[model samples]
Target: MTKFRPCIDLHAGQVKQIVGGTLDSSTDALKTNHVSLEPAGHFARLYRDHDLRAGTLSCWGPRTTRPPLRRWPPGQGACRSGAGSTTGTPGFTSYLFPEGKFSQERLDAVLHSLDGDKQKLVIDLSCRRRGEDRWFVAMNKWQTITDMEVNQETIKQLEPYCSEFLIHAADNEGLQKGIDETLVQRLAEWCSIPVTYAGGGRHLEDLDLVAKLSGGKVDLTIGSALDCFGGSGVKFDDCVAWNNKS
Candidate 1:
């Protein structure tokens, strides 16, 4: 079954709804929709109403800011939801660490916001080197401070508390070019828990490719080519239909 999983990617401390392909080395080039002037949980609550479990909270680097303090001390007061309609959509939160910028304190803060519920969490092992914005380097090739490999180790440390993994072949991300078969197979063999592979999806058939390569275990995140992401080939509605049938 092809399920529709939406995302809210946070970059440079902002809640941006972006078109995947537009992201590049320069922030100025990225096309993003700013949702709030506050913390990320607000968005998470919105997804919850839609039954969107596992919405990702992605961070680009150490520059990522902490959510508002007032919202902390979870369960203290009623969770005030924003004015909107949920309409039952599925989503997930991921924290994409830029190369050499992984921080235990920052990760701890994100985990604390979840209030000890591992099932609702998904961490993105995404990283790029300094001054490089083309694509995220693979875990093995990374050598800098913000490497995804380091971030993966961090997630392993937090494994007892986390639920799923969201790893992207930054080298292939947003390209809609092709899949990195090696990475897909490796993640399926290495990770015990469920993981979503994002990057280099050019068509619907690519999903089938992933299913075969990962033994129908690993899922995928499609951007760039999706109709919503400024592309005309892939239809978001078709994905929903496929998920319904599955």
Candidate 2:
């Protein structure tokens, strides 16, 4: 069945649900929601309530802030030391590492914050350079790092921890111009796990294109042109129905 995978995108520690195409080049272009301060876990819990499966928690940009933690009593110093200090406030931050370091410290911190079975969850390595489309840059500044290549070795390393992969062709992301067939095909062949391709989807037909090119194995993320994302031409319900039928 085609499931509705909703997303809660976090930027600079804020929970924002935005149209993928409308993302601004500058910080001024972001729209904020006053009601979404409860962090990624809150939305994840809501998704659990709805019985929605295959959803993702995508963190963008940098992990400049400390990990969020469960609210603690004042003067108890619960978060003043140890892993408590390294961990972000629970119900607030989603424990996303923007640089994709996946270091022991980062992995430990994220694992510590998870409330459910770790094996069942799929973490999104969703990232992009601001103001660009179709290209992906590494989130970390490791000395061995080079260009924006999504090679086979990297995928192998991440496979054990993640069940699926969410990759955006940043060069074409949000442009609604067209799909990146090469990237889709490569990812589909390179990784054994299921993959969702997001970027440059301006119409319903693009979905078909993705399915065809990826041999009916790849899923897609639509934005900007979708009615839900403040676009008028494409109806979100139609896409849902299409997915249901397909």
Candidate 3:
């Protein structure tokens, strides 16, 4: 079924909704949509209260600013998110995983590590559109575009390595304009495993659009537009109700 998945995107220990394209190293270039004063636990409790499952808690900050995971002190919170930098480095593609010598071995080593637990890995295929209809996968905090194109073939090839795919349309994320409908349709067609699509969800009706377009196969994540996230488009309670009905 097409469900509404919740997300908590933490930046510098605070929950925030940020523009996906401006996620470079430059603070001046970074555009923020919403910053919540509530800690990660607040959202965690809320999701639990509403019986929301498969929710994502993403830490989108540098290592130094990341929140500690220790729960020793009662008030302290724990959050672990992936971070990277592409500033001042030319040809950052050199840092691409399994690209250099013994690339196959490196890839095999990773696959071997998860041999019995491949389901624990979830691949994020966040991407940006190139020409009119082409979408290429972006890496390194989405600052660099790789040669890989986001299509059925790529989805099939990588399916064996991960249990699920989380795709965010780089251009539409945090804009509250609308979701990339074409990309959602293609994802529905290509992906056999569970896939969650995030970016540019404005109203509650988007859930219906995704349900129709993907035939209730792809789940949608609304970040910036949710009422709890400081947007007026979709109320958080409504989302819970939608999930209950779904």
| TM-score of every prediction relative to native | 0.58, 0.60, 0.84
The lDDT of each candidate is 0.51, 0.51, 0.73
Give candidate 2's error at residue 66 in angstroms: 14
Question: For every candidate structure, what is the RMSD over all alpha carbons to the true structure, in angstroms?
Answer: 8.8, 8.8, 5.7
- lDDT score, candidate 1, position 90: 14
User: Which one is best on lDDT?
Assistant: 3
Give per-residue lDDT, candidate 3, residue 57.
58
Q: What value of lDDT does candidate 1 attain over all alpha carbons?
A: 0.51
lDDT of 1 by residue, 1-246 (tens): 324354445556665544344554566766553334645666555444444333344444235543442433454321221101111111122222333444556556556666756655555554332342223433322222243342345445756655666766655655567877767776666677777777677787777788888887777766556664455557766655555565
Worst 10 residues of 1 by lDDT: 81-90
Instruction: Compare candidates 1 and 2 on lDDT and give the better one.
Output: 1
**Candidate 2 lDDT score relative to the true structure:** 0.51
Question: Which regions in candidate 2 have their CA more than 4 angstroms from the true location?
Answer: 1-5, 8-26, 29-52, 57-105, 108-118, 127-148
